[model samples]
Target: MTILDARESGLANGGPSFSLGNRLLRAVWIPVWRLGAGWTPRQLHPWRRFLLRAFGARMAPGSDVRASAKVWYPANLEMHEGAIIGPGVNVYSMGKITVGRKALVSQGVHLCAGTHDFDTPLFQLEAKPITIGAHAWIAAEAFLGPGARIGEGAVVGARAVAFGELEPWTVYSGNPARAIRQRRRFADDASNS
Candidate 1:
């Protein structure tokens, strides 16, 4: 993923992090989403998907996002077929956030694609894309930092904090998540598992 430096992008020096048009769209989207799908029942995935897609999210057929999930920028999100973003998940898509086919992000997970550059005096913002590979399972309340790549079929345990790349078919747990064990690889039936 390409990192976007706010200082180089002209967003530092007291400038706003986002362009005017982007802000305006978000302003309009906030209430639209709140009233349109936020109050819907959990079973109304299609309605929620429609609202997200209207804001430019690339949601494949069978991809599901819960009504309570908060997406910072729908335009920066992409969900492959059968991908699920569970209730109360926060998708802070300052950059792009891609959920691969059948990937499941559990409740209250934070997928943050933006952070501040602490070394810089100005504390400039930096954004990098996050990718969750196919069949990956992120357990409840986990935190994924900017540029995190959860490999295919990997499982991140509940409340874990993860950054960087995780190996495919691995089980990770704890703060600054470490691989706990190798998961059994499933062949073409990821949905069933």
Candidate 2:
């Protein structure tokens, strides 16, 4: 994933952060998504998926995104099979956000893939990618900052704020998420099934 510096990319000097084409796509997408899928019933996953795909989201079959969830740029999203973006989740995909197979992003979670470069004089926007590995679970209300990488089978507890890399098969919680415990290996836990 490329980290974009808005200033260096010629978007500084009071110019819009995104190109006209990007703005135009979003302009058409917002209302289309709202009218076509945002108010649909929860059971209409296929319908929602179709609209998302039409807008350039890479949604694998069986992936589900709730009606109340807000995806900033569908073109920057990629969800593998069985990945679920729950109700009220905010996918601020100013950059790429890849949700691996079977990952679950619970309700109210905020996946922010962009932030301002505070040290820069222009305070220019910086876009970095976020990745949630296969079988990971990001609990309700969690905030994942730009460049966060949640490993496979990891659990980010409710309301946690995560940044950078989280080890696989671990449980993390709190504001600056820390490993609270090592998660039991899913392969060894047949009881869940």
Candidate 3:
């Protein structure tokens, strides 16, 4: 329950969250993915998609992953059609991450599905899934923490950190990502005008 208790339990008993084979797979695939998939031309989406898919990612056609974006584990990632992961995005998907259709993850965004339990001496790994719903927008420099969910048409403003679920058609901002306003559906705008 406490750090002291964890220390008394012994570090030898505590182990990595994943298997050795999984670690080895990442060791081999990371460099290759960085070199090949991360430096390719923006137009070469299929090639990049192929690389991700080969490593077990589920991505639909027309989903754009920028060259500079980093995915920690492709096996835990899923992107639906028209999803866009912009430049400098880091997806640390230790657990499942699903991006719905037409979702936009802007530049410098970090989607982190893993963290360490600070209460323990060994710092046991804690992981949870992240979901970005259809037409949701995670703006530049935003951070989506473990178990965060951005609902359909929601927008997370620049530099915000989402640690909980966002409501559909809402706009969020600030460090902990508070709801600031309701988002209007773009499709309804033309009719409203």
Candidate 4:
């Protein structure tokens, strides 16, 4: 393979260190979260709501977690004021996950925080924190992979996979999620004018 082809291959799948930690984190977290999962059954929305509240998910008053949404670890997830984790969204946070104020994680979106390594003896897993900045919108069916750091006011378009950092106020989409364009401005001064 040419140098360019090898480089492309590396970009698609990360290196050994990255892979190792992701796998280990997932192995450790899944069972721990699953143990707590029974407190909130698949259909029991109210029960789930209470469980999340018991954990340290700092939801502001009146912020809602829809029934169909699943939080793998309520204690490890933090949602700021006015954040909406909508229906059918799965927050699988083996690593620390934070969603800033007014961020919207729409329906069927998967926020994944862990992956496994192939190089290690045990196939060690690596985990990286996922952060969605304030006012960001993760549209329907979008997936935020490990180490995804979505910037403030950014929008990941429907079905996008944000594998890395996203620029603030930018719109992104596609498999690895390239920046599409700057989001439209809606300044307070413009409204006044």
Model 3, TM vs. native: 0.88
Candidate 3, pairs of clashing residues: none
- Score each candidate by Cα lDDT: 0.89, 0.89, 0.84, 0.71
Candidate 2 C-alpha error for residue 147, in Å: 0.3
Ranking by TM-score: 1, 2, 3, 4
Candidate 3 least-lDDT 10 residues: 1-10
Q: TM-scores of all models?
A: 0.93, 0.93, 0.88, 0.71
Question: To one decimal, what is the Cα RMSD in angstroms of model 4 from the true structure?
Answer: 8.8
Task: Give candidates' CA RMSD values in order.
Answer: 2.5, 3.1, 5.3, 8.8
Put down candidate 1 lDDT per residue, 70-122, tens digits, no spaces.
99989999999999999999999988999999999999999999998888786
**Once superposed on the true structure, which residue ranges of model 3 sit more than 4 Å away at CA?**
1-12, 188-193
- Candidate 4, residue 138: Cα displacement in angstroms equals 0.5
lDDT (Cα, tens digit) per residue for candidate 3, span 1-193: 1122333323447655566666787897789788888778889988988889989999998988888999998888999988989999999988888998889999999999988777867677666789998889999999999989888889999999998789988999998899999988877322210
Task: List candidate 4 stretches off by more than 4 Å.
Answer: 1-49, 186-193
lDDT of 1: 0.89
Model 1 weakest 10-residue run by lDDT:
1-10
